[model samples]
Target: MQESISVCHNQYILKPQSIESEELENATFHAKQRAIEARQTISPWKKSHSLYETGGWKSLFENINQPLNLSTQSKEFQTRYNESANSLEQVVESAKLPLCPSGQPEIGNTVVFGVVGGTVEAPSIAYLTESQPVTEEILALSDSVKPTEIFRIASSCQADACRHFDGANCRLAVRIVQQLPTVVETLPACQIRSSCRWWQQEGKAACYRCPQMVTDNGYSSKILQEVGDPYSK
Candidate 1:
């Protein structure tokens, strides 16, 4: 009798590593500080999904006007209002891109890792080359594993369902930067870099540590626990 065995081609195992408890504590503290700083910079409208979608510029205008009474006949006021309106319009237009989560299966991208071996102590990973397709067989295999163990990346519109979203920015990106060590000085060659939310929000710093990220279904890192996983309640 012959037996069937699954072969994962173009796959590389990501060995697990340990971090000192003190190091984890520091990362967690820093991640909270980063989130606080980030919240301060975020526009009020950007933090609310309803406002962001309804029209961030419109909301800004309403807020600005709520505090004062303006007359159209006043030339100086009209001029200042027009300038502010133009600036607000520019901001609202630029915020149209949808959010994309790291784990979402976007078409064409490869399954970067499988969750076959991972634990709370050290999350294991299995990487697939860019050329490899995430076949139905692969996805089926993924279903049998812990949801967090299977890591995949693909292009897709960002939506409200993502945990990292604060209705404004991807907090996960910020936490990842605060927690992980930069494995590379330069941005790793990534197909999704252009549209990546992390790159868009945090820039080069996010890219520096991106290679070390794994979307664990369980709370795998201290920083994640501190920040509160969006996927969790």
Candidate 2:
């Protein structure tokens, strides 16, 4: 004779079993019906009462039907997240933009802060009492060399538009703080200190280290190469 629930009429027979969850019972019964209609049903070959009769199966399904506390927790988490986001948005919106000028004069909106005796090892940037606009005559001075090799230029910091800007912050400024050694104890006077991107991001640490950074390093210093490299891990 066949075990308790065997096929009687070219169908996968499932002997009825009591299910505690009404929703789960309806869903499973519908799924069984669909399987039979599809003509691709499998036999309950594990055992006759393997589907739901065992205490393990009953307990598992009963546990699944228990009400979840996740919704309340999720709501609380979202409220905190919203508050933090609003606070950051307020800060970003009100803050004045700082300078992040590159080496080129054609980039526009730049000021020259005359850098003297710029050697491969390191360069000291001498600030003018006030910034001088980068003009064609000044650019002509560097016929054989890069303009930045002779001059330290400062310009308005481009936030998201620049590659160095990682969304909310400038990675270049962060690198300047982390990789470069502080050269000055007191904050060095610069034309752009109040509006310098590095100053805004890293405070006096960046200013202290500012004396060593060259706009166009030409991979001259190992530390400069590492600090200026945008792709470093």
Give candidate 2's whole-model lDDT. 0.48
- lDDT for model 1 comes to 0.40
Q: Clashing residue pairs in candidate 1, if any?
A: 99-158, 106-154, 148-217
User: What tens digits encode model 2's per-residue C-alpha lDDT throughout 1-233?
Assistant: 01123234422222212222223323333323332332232222322221111112232223333222334423543344345454666435433466673433433356776343322333344445556677655555554454565566775553544556787887877887887666555665576777777777788878776765656433234445555655543
Per-model TM against the reference: 0.44, 0.55
Ten residues in a row with the worst lDDT in model 1?
49-58
lDDT of 1 by residue, 1-233 (tens): 11112225422233232233224323333323433333344433232322112212232233342222123213333343456544665435434653343443322233332222233333332222232334443344343332223443443333333445667776666766776655444444454556667788888987665544444333233443443344422
The clash tally of candidate 2 reads: 0
- Candidate 2's error at 167, in angstroms? 0.7
Instruction: Give the clash count for each candidate.
Output: 3, 0
